[model samples]
Target: MQDSESLQIARAMRRIPRWWLIPVVVLVVLAGLGAAYWAGTSTTAGTESTPPLAAVVPVSATVERRAVVKQVVLSGKVVAGAESVLQASHAEGVDRLVVTAVAKEAGSHVAPGDLLAVVSGRPLLILPAGVPLYRDITQGEAGPDVESLQTVLTSWGYACPVTGSFDLPTQQALGFWYKAAGFKAPTASDPISQGEAGSAAPKPSSSDIMFRWREFVQVPGDTGKVASIAGSGAILADDGVVARIRVADDAIVARADVVQAEQFAVGMRVTVRAGSTALDTTVAKVSSFLEGEHSENTIPGKDITVALPPGAQGFAAGQSVTVTAGSAATESLAVPLIAIRQEGGRPYLLVQANDQKNDQANGQPRRLEVKITAQADGWAAIADVDGLLVGDEVTLQ
Candidate 1:
């Protein structure tokens, strides 16, 4: 009976289907693959999520001595003022007033006793401010006009009496003037004989010279620059204008907007530019014009007038120019604006603390409090109780 039971158990085991064994084998293989996938995913996640430590470096600049100034650039044009007119006056024994020769042209500088032009064979001369030459001055004339002539002669180092009389000394001085001016002196009138018998020649009169009214023209100013003059051979009526002289220096006139005008004031120093040339000048006047007051086609604004320095050159009327005006330049210890940091409404800088300037790694940067005295062109002029010296390195970030 035990043998029969053992045989029956063997047959039962053999009778079990091989397909059920295949499914168990497949499940074991799938579990192994799932474990491997989970392990790879966790390892990859841990490697990707971790970050490495890094050392940060900052940008830096060196402190330097610099000038800080805030300026406004404006477009302007040159203007001339106080123009004097030279006129052609009627002369004795001359029919037509014709410009015979032009000695000085436009843009020439002139002084007292300078020849302007020639009118009908008579010289036109510039004289100092004096009495109007209404009549001819001959010998023995006594008046304010004669005194004025004497005064001019005295100024020219001539020995003439300022006694309001065209005496011997006056005629002698006039002769000197005529010779120096490259002209011949006018002949005096003939003297009368006493009685045609043993008569002396009346002491031969002091000099044989007289002054004609039309030769000398008085200028309104001491010195001037010619603006315009009549061409040679031009004809004119009595008392016609011959030349225009500028008694005042050139001025820069510019219109500024309301904001820019507010920053401008009289006596401010300025720089005027014409092409490659530049001149230093000062603000002469500042005025405001209401809407439609200054011109019909212009906007309301402030007119800035700048006076060119005495003897300024290379500028002409109506020529375009550039004007730069602002606060005076302040020179101090300065640094780049990027190096400044603000904290709690106070400005500070990160200065390198290392005594060895090149050894940046030896010491940590120090925070320094500073007062910004001025700022311009990306530079800040600073002042501090603990002074920051020039050539010191400062971190920008």
Candidate 2:
């Protein structure tokens, strides 16, 4: 009955109502359905929203056993050592650079005082290398160093201000005297009034400085220490040729096993190589360790080393190079890299002094000073391990 009634109504409306009325009713019904669909989708909004995953951080182990060193250290540097400083009698002009020369490259040899390079100035010859120098006029005593220089200058007519002291004017006077005498200009070897000496002569312009250079031949050889003012201007050498002209660059020039002064020490860790075999070298010079310079970019490291290679082939004085020092030894304590601290200009190491409290049964925690034998990467060095017993409970700091 209801269906029949609805059908009748629909027919009646279709027959009586206008087209606009039916269209309006249908549009309103569609809007209502759309609103209901939106409400259903929006219900689970809280459960749908979730952020993305984040990154993870790695954790590192705080303790590990250090490796035991057993290999024979094939001690060697990648480059040759600095060439020896060509020392002359503090003379100003006799080819001041004669003693320097390209004796040989990384693997060559040469005699003493051989012609390495030509320098400007007179060659003075009173002292040999490694002589401690302090300036004084004693060599010419009553013959004051100043008056002697002034007399030489005045005679040459430079009218050097007689300061009664060997100052710049005096040096200039000396230079003038030398040039006027048709010899290379000279510098003082400490400004002493020497009795019978002046440079021989200067060569004509085109002549190489080598022509005016005084010759110094290599005798047998005593591995003696050589020293001079601390600068090797330009003039680099591999085998005697100035491969690099780095002027005014300072470098160290050391002879075999030589250090300045009477201070001698036993360096244990060193580099020793024989062709292909790398030997763990023994050091004898504690001072051999380089104390790097101070600067913004400086990584200061101390050298506890023995002397440079003894008779290492192809090394020269004043060669710029670096090396990996050998292992060092302390009396008996093998102090681990951890447990060492630096404070107030001293190094402190933790020792297992009390056996009762020690977990490792060596000893309990106590502080002791262990003579440093050598250091690498991260570890405390000791020459002997007697005092540091096995299983000594050294804390891993």
Q: Top model by TM-score, which number? A: 1
Stretches of candidate 1 above 4 Å error?
1-67, 80-83, 130-135, 138-144, 184-210, 237-239, 246-250, 255-269, 273-303, 307-321, 327-380, 383-397
Q: Write the per-residue lDDT of candidate 1 for residues 134-196, one digit (tens) a residue.
A: 877887888988998899889899999799988889998886786677655564563221222
Q: What would the TM-scores of all predictions be? A: 0.55, 0.25
Error of 2 at 362 (Å): 33
Off by over 4 Å in 2: 1-19, 22-26, 35-63, 67-307, 313-397
Model 2 TM-score on a 0 to 1 scale: 0.25
lDDT of 2 by residue, 1-397 (tens): 9999999999898787466788899999999999998887888674687877987532211222343343232122333333344333333322323323232333333332222232223232212222223333321222344564455446547766766655555555544444443345322332222222243333222111111122221212312222222223533233322222111212122222223212223544445443454434444434434444566332233333434444554444433333333343323344556666566756655654453454444444566455565555565555443445545555555
- Pairing residues by index, what is the TM-score of model 1? 0.55
* Clash count (model 1, backbone only): 0
Candidate 2 worst ten-residue window by lDDT: 206-215
Clashes of each: 0, 54
RMSD in angstroms, candidate 1?
12.4
Alpha-carbon shift of residue 54 in model 2 (angstroms) = 11
Which candidate comes out best when scored by lDDT? 1
